[model samples]
Target: MRPVVFDGQFGWLHPAAGPHGVVLCYPFGYDALCTYRGMRRLAERLAARGIAVLRFDYPGTGDSAGDASEPGRWRAWIDSITKAVALLRQSTGVERVSLCGLRLGGTLAALAAQQLGDVDGLVLLSPVLSGKNYQRELRAGYRQWLSMPAAMDCTPEPDTDEFVEAYGFRLYREALENLRAVDLRRDAAAPARRVLMLDSLDAARVDALAAHYREQGIEVERRGFDEYSKFMMESLDSEIPRAAFESVENWLAAGSGELATAARDADTHLSADDPQGHAVEAGVTETPVWIDGGRMFGIYCMPHASLVTTGGTPAVLMVNTGAVSRIGNARLGVRFARRLARQGIASLRVDLGGLGDSQPSLDTVTLDALYAQDGANDAACAARWLAARGHPGVVLLGICAGAYVGLYAGSREPAVTGAVLVNLQKFTWRNICDETGKPTVRVAAIGSTRSYLRSMCEPRKWLRVVKGQTGGWPVARELAARCASRLRATLADRIERITGLELGASEERRPFAALDARGVPTRLLYGVLDDGVEELEKYFGVRGARLRRLRRVKVSFREHMDHAILSASAQENVMSYFEDFYRSQFGEQPGAVADEPADSRDAGRSGRRARAAQWLARQARAFRLSGEA
Candidate 1:
């Protein structure tokens, strides 16, 4: 790796041998050094094709200097990236410069490209189009924390400040405010800049932004990828997929003539079917719409069926994995959203603050880095996104972790009218055993050591010693203690202090308290064969109907569906229940079509009763074989 520093922003710059020009690459969030490995491979591949690559980090992110918590740091970060691009041109003696960015970096690159006229081409991989949603996510997150009774006392629990997760940096308000001002739509049209947009399934907002560029007569090409590459969130043996690299390489190799033709052709298709195309109902075409959350990078779908003419549709905002992009979950969320949309009910599929093409994970960095509060944030963001697009009512339809986030967010945010928790895990004790089947308590201990040391090393160390020891075990028990004691010692207290923020049995029970206090409507659905079903039932019982207003049901599926809505059979069953629930609540629309009419009719006639009988049969079979309950 060729380590290079430009204006205090450090990164690796790979120069092509007798290069055609330089391409500056910016990665999402705290993924500075790690991002380069993929770009380096691309650089070499592109260099062989005659292009140099420059990859760097913004200040306060990655290995770059400055605290990410400072005000106006995002602008400064953009400025730093722009400067680095210039430096690459100067250092490489190249006249033309191409810019490439992933997620928020893509938005930043577009903004910078607008200001820097020297840019030749721009490659935006899932660019965030709004910043306001990103801010709402931050506020919603704070609300989630505050909503947890006595959770936000504002008293600093020692070493509970910093957290790092797969998403990115974990600064509370600092990153949030900075990200709230970025607007890619405003900067979409860069004069004389050739733009290439790479999208996965969740590219509605970005595609819309790209369409704006095309309308401005800017050269733009949009490419869709089939696979989900978690390069930004996790370190893989390979970073950028071969297909993505090949596509970009082909686009670059063709030169301006082919590029211009490609752009025009792509724009032609985009215009014909406006990337944000709405579902057709009753021979009327509705525009699929998105609500921008300013700099916060929150984007939500607003279906046309929810219009007043549709007699007020029942809506659901689908939530998914914190680490996975909204695009990756599109197969499930889109399927459900379309199904709901087809039923004369609306569904808003939202990209949580940091995930997807919304914004850098730094923008809404959570304390646990999991957006432990994102479910609430997502609910609020979805509502805001919907209200902005003129939808009056919305609910939550979440699966697995998405269900948890939706439930948490729905409880805190009033915008959520209702929530459907599918395959919920009320209380989970994951990582119980290591690969060798040994208890993982020791491993957890070692992981907590670093936190422990940080707390002890603080100025008021002696005064905080008791807090440190009590908190230390949360970390120590979470990691493998067999690792270096030094590593264990380093994380000990900090891990405890941070883990201390976690909702214990009592704290976890508070949502039920808030539900009782607020009287929110909730529906909990679980597969009986699924793990943790008993625990979830207990949770619902503990919270009780007063707070939760919960109606719980256990689906009698013979096989366990491992969370992702992966099985077609499982998906069909879940969708059927969702459609029925939505229809019952919102009433049927004039000309809404059912995706699975045969299944719907069959389900309506005898599905539930038949499933019940099957469950009984299984129970009888087990009893006869084992002679036990």
Candidate 2:
């Protein structure tokens, strides 16, 4: 995967040996984040078939420079498609080009094709047909969330007169107006020779749109696809849509003779200013690195200007939160990293071994790998790597299971002067049962059982529990287990206090206490009504006072946020917490610079390799220091 800068936006290119190239335009906000890994996988599958492909974040989104605060972003997104098309054509020598867009991206692609009159073919996956209809759908989702049992404890809803915020981003009044105007049924059919539209989960919305295109003399094929919701819904472990991918592959494989000739002719008319007809700031730059002897993969984000100037090595290391990859839930880490870069603070968001692009660790597979056992080891390696590369004051940041890892990893690594733990689900390591029957682990729903217990307070769930469908013994056993667990924790705390040293609860066995002793500036944020909060109280007394009593440990109840931090308003709370933590713990720094092309490749390689070696050495030293070697 090659990261590129086009029209001041960040995108990844998968080069293929085929003559045709495709550009993948993603949907906006949370949908884009949820489907990122799936999209990346789709790109790889296409590339493997000898078709070069490009997947990009629209302007003010993903790893890009601007954000939702920027006005006229709706228009900018439409123009971005044109820029992406040009980029794919120029980067690869492919004579033919096709556009594949999901949701709003599909709409933008059609609009761009109309303007450029260059695209050879189009593929729309779950394309949004009418903006007004989409908005209503979003509003319906919001209402459903509001009525959920968990919403009772959420922070009071924020008042937004001009915008509707959801899934960590908002669409303004003007944007909604733009959406209302985007009725593809009314627009003239794009000049593409063939079009393929996949309806998500048999919503049956695209049939009429495709019929409209067919009436306009356009070749349109519409298919009902069930995996659309599976791909676009949020999950730690995303299941890539094999059927949909295969369909797209089969369609693209059927070639047209005019495709190449038309593509070449269109390339001749392309210019830098052709897309938006204005210059854009190339803000943050990314360098992909392979660490831990090439077993771990990460992307280092630096401000463009920081390339030339020598300064303090300040950076944040963000780990994969659950199975959601390095971008964090809803691309939160990406936005956080770019924001830090803009403030001259470098950050690395890495996929711990066996996740995303990172290779699996020895003795483990993707589905069964134990995250808690080796998370500290991986994070420690990451911290040491940053330290070796001149970043001395590194902060470890993670969410959910990633937070659990950061707590242990940051406690052990001196380079990690601070740590941010968001919505940590559990303190103890629990092995997940898999088909292999070998001890294995991935991101576990540790607090989900507690959530289920809370749900029993409702009469309907209680009825189910009493019925044979749920089994009464299982519920009773769960209650008994919770009581026993709390009893054990209470005894353990008492034993530690009496002996002045943990008896059975050693540093390795007890992460929270160890973290407190290490005196690292730690911030723990949990959702207001998250079941994890009850888990916290169970282990550390009411409000987690056992940990909060420590001078360096801080805890907060984040309002109006789910455990996943899925909403824009919730994300703002997370971002504000981090910004405050950085300022308080590390002080201020200069604004970061944009990309300097000369050093990005070579610098990243040598730096990553050297850091990998140092990390290994550091691990050896740590083992020796602890007498574990």
Q: Tens-digit lDDT track for model 1 on 399-436?
A: 65666677677667766665667756543233444454
Question: lDDT scores for all predictions?
Answer: 0.50, 0.69
Residue pairs in candidate 2 whose N, alpha carbon or C atoms collide under 3 angstroms: 155-560, 168-567, 168-568, 303-593, 304-593, 304-594, 304-595, 305-593, 305-594
Best by lDDT: 2
Off by over 4 Å in 1: 1-292, 296-310, 328-330, 361-367, 388-390, 426-506, 516-519, 537-560, 588-629
Error of 2 at 145 (Å): 3.4
Best-fitting candidate, scored by TM-score: 2
Candidate 2 similarity to native, TM-score: 0.77
lDDT of 2 by residue, 1-629 (tens): 55577767877787776788889988877677667667777887777677888898788777665776678988898888888888888888888888898888888887877777777788988888877778877676666766564453445356564777555467778778888887676553654878998886325557777777788778888887788777776644445778988999888867533223222211222221222211224556666666776667677777666442365755899998777667676678878787777777888898887665566412123323435558778988988878887876788888877888898888778888888888887676656756753345444323444455556678986687657556667557766776676667666666666775554434333665566677677777776666676577567643453553365676666556677676656678777877777776666432211111223223436777765764465345422221101
Q: Ten consecutive residues with minimal summed lDDT in candidate 1?
A: 260-269
Name the lDDT value of residue 165 in candidate 1. Answer: 19
